[model samples]
Target: METKNINIPAHGSNVLRADIPAEYKWHVQDIYADEAAWQAACAEFKALLPQLEALKGSITSAQGLYNALHLQDKMSQMLDKLYAYPRLQQDADNTDQHLQAIAGEAEALAAAFSSANSFIEPEMLGLGKEKVAAMLAELPELAEYKFYVENLLRITDHILSADKEAIFAQSRLATGTAASAFRSLVSADMEFPPITDGEGKPAIVSEGNYMLNMTSPDRELRKNSFRGLMGTYHKYRNTLATTLTGSARTAYFYASVHNYKDTLESCLAEDNIPTSLYDGLIQTVHDNFAPLHEYIQLKKDVLGYDEFHPYDLYMPLSKAADSFACTFPEACAKVEEALAPLGEDYIATLHKGLTEGWIDIYENKGKRSGAYSWGVYGVHPFVLLNYQQRYSSISTLAHEMGHALHSYYSSMNQTYVNSEYTIFCAEVASTTNENLLLEYTLQRANDEQKIYLLNQFLEAVRTTVYRQVQFAEFEKFIHGEITAGRSLQAEKLENYWLESNRQYYGPALTVDQELASEWSRIPHFYTPFYVYKYATGYSAATAFSSAILSGAPDAVEKYLGFLKAGGSDYSLNILKNAGVDLNTPQPVTVTLQKFA
Candidate 1:
């Protein structure tokens, strides 16, 4: 594959989607050649819904069980393709009403399929464990489904009746209302006032450029941007608080219905993660805040500030290398070179993904913000990136490609039923790539570049591990409040936010009032109990990257095995097999020590 020089557009440019070169866009056509083919596939998928419904009561025998699961898997794979095509189209340019409507239709189709197949679990559980065991023993083909069947049996106490299960599945479409409204308010409706840029000129602030403004070398811009963004959220604080509370209430409702102890337990139950692990993470971080506080003090002293504030957190310590930039091709080459420890095949596949249509590489007007890697089972994973010519964008490229390759390796090695890994394990692959990239870059840097790179690395740890754990702690608090029958009012939420920041950053930083409203802007809060995984993932990645970089025997192979293991087993078992255990606080402790 030949690499070409692809020039990235200036930051904040408004180029239209059509203007982006074809070579830079992901090939959604690979999923379906055109919309006509997508319609045909959708029709065929709808036609097979009744076949799945027909097998509802016939799962008594091993052959019947295998047949039902096989049909479900087939339709699932089809639906995945059906869903990815239009969704990818819409993500490319959300301003297209036609694409949006079709994406909605695909989403509804997915919901309908989920509702139709809701009976399988209840019906399977209706067969006693003894009977299921007997059926498995009787049929050889059931070997593939042994884990799926046993997992359902394992959660037998939580499995509802067929009618209730179907109702629950249907309710999912409505249950997302809170999250949907939150997204609309933050992404579409909310607006930030213009702030002074580092150049003493007017600059607009939006969700996309807010971080860019925060990292500006100009102290006034960072301060104004922080206030402008958070002040906007503060204005809508009541509504935002209601939406967050609604989500927490919804989580509490589901946990109660499922007979779980709390929302945290219910959220972690899907992957069978222990609640102790979550609590231990917070405890470990609480015990090890010295390094984080020390870093804060170091930054404050280096910046020559009388006092550090929330806005001062992201400024780089080294000003000399502040203008560092790289083009898209340069970023890709750097990522590929940085990832060479994974051996020839991994690098070769990564090169293919970079050159081929697997990546949509530039930002366009109405294009989705941020970066992600997503794909259907049979297709190569596709990455969506608003590639900017900065070191952070290069790091993001490495992070997202890590996810893509994880999905790639998993799909290549595992059956469809087991190919999708849990969110718990997903971040480990991405952050491992990030750690490796940072290490590789640091090794080859000059003194000034080393200062810049070290600043970036420490800041990544501060935000990814320390700051995320702060968010996780607050998340747990809100959910616990709801579980204990309290309202998540705006004032209470703000107070907790302020206090948590104070505690996490310590005496070096002054927690501003505007910073209190920061919680309202985090979209992750809508997805309850999700942020801690970022911290844990970073810690686990630190462990894996350290071992691999140290030339530990079999480390690369074991890490690759973890990626390929996918959802074949529980998340903890997979990480444990790869030689990092999150059950103990050792990984988190070691990560903090590294930061120190």
Candidate 2:
């Protein structure tokens, strides 16, 4: 595949999927060839569920265990491919009813697969560790699953009875109701009134364009966009509150049933992360507030605002880099040049992904708003990007490709069972790329551009580290409230969010009332305790990128090893061996000091 010359459509064009060239769109066919093939695979997968059920109670023997495990891997790989096709299509253009129906069907199939396969773990746990170890030793081929078995046995205390496990697995179908409702409400139901654009024309306020509006130089537009966005959520406050409360309660229910102390423990336990690390992240950020405050104060000074408001936060301080923009091809070239420090092989693979139909490179009518990188186990990774002709879009390209390359390396090296990495380490690869891109751009910048790029780096750390930790702190509070038998009422949640913002941003900034409703709009809150990883990942990336750029011995080699390790080992241990340790506060503190 060769790189194609494609330009992003002008803003507000309402470009259709057919308007974009084929190369600019990802090849979902690469997963299944067509919908007919996907349907056939789904049927084949359904037929194999009974076969998996047949091995449920037969894992006592070495051969029985191997057969069950191997079959499970095979089925899982099939399901991954099966699910990826429709989800990718739906994300590309969600307006199509057929795509929506298939996506829903794929989700249902996944839930069914989960319920059917729930018995494997409990049954394996029933055999006892020593017996399972004996079976593993008896079968040389089982060596591949030794780590998995050991990890399972390590959490044996949490594994419930077979019946209870089945109930829990079936609960998967209902567990996502809160999150699903939240997505529907925000994406489809909620409507923000149009705000004036920087040019004094009416611009629609959407989740996609909200950030773009925030970055606009027009002060009224920024304030109105902020007000319009958050005020709409405020109008639906009660409904949004109920949805979030349901999500929290759901998490608490699972935590309590699993014998964990709290939702935080239950969430971190999967990756073997300690609750102390999560707590320490908040405390460490609290301890190091001067740099953040100083930055905020500088922003206020630069913007010449008597009262600094939430809407003013994203405004570019440097006029020079504020107008920076790049087309999709230019963004790709910039990212490739920025990532060249990872060596020729890494860049070559990245170029292949950029050129080949591995990316849906531009936003279209009804496409997903944000960006992500996801892939089937055996096939190459795919990236969904709403590419704009701006520096932020370039950085986003680098960030997501970092995820893509991480997935690519892991899938190439690990089995399907371990190809998926934990959320704890997911941000490391992506942020490292962002950090490298910033560094590359800064190095090549003139004096005026340097000021802008430096501010960009500062804002990245502030957002990725400080802002995320603030969100983490809020998560801990809300979950603790639920754990303590309290409710997450709308007003109560809003009040807490206000106070938290004040404490984090300090007196340098005025806490707007609209900002209090900000918590209601964050979709990540549906996934309890997940946001802190962005902060931790940024810290770890800072460490890795510093070392790699400073010519540390084998730094690139070590970082690549971390990517390839995937979920094959514990997340913390993987990072430890790769040189950053989240077990201590050094990484966070060191990252903050750089900001200072």
Point to the candidate with the largest lDDT: 2
RMSD in order of candidates: 1.8, 1.7
How many collisions per candidate? 0, 0
User: Which residue pairs in candidate 2 collide?
Assistant: none
Off by over 4 Å in 1: 1-6, 10-13, 320-323
lDDT of 2 at 309: 95
For 296-399, candidate 1 gives per-residue lDDT tens digits of: 99999999999899999998888644455767787888999999999898999899888889998877766667788995799999998887657888899999
Q: For candidate 2, what is the TM-score? A: 0.97
Q: How far off is model 1, as Cα RMSD?
A: 1.8
lDDT of 2 at 237: 91
Q: Which stretches of candidate 2 lie over 4 Å from their true place?
A: 1-7, 10-21
lDDT value for model 2: 0.87
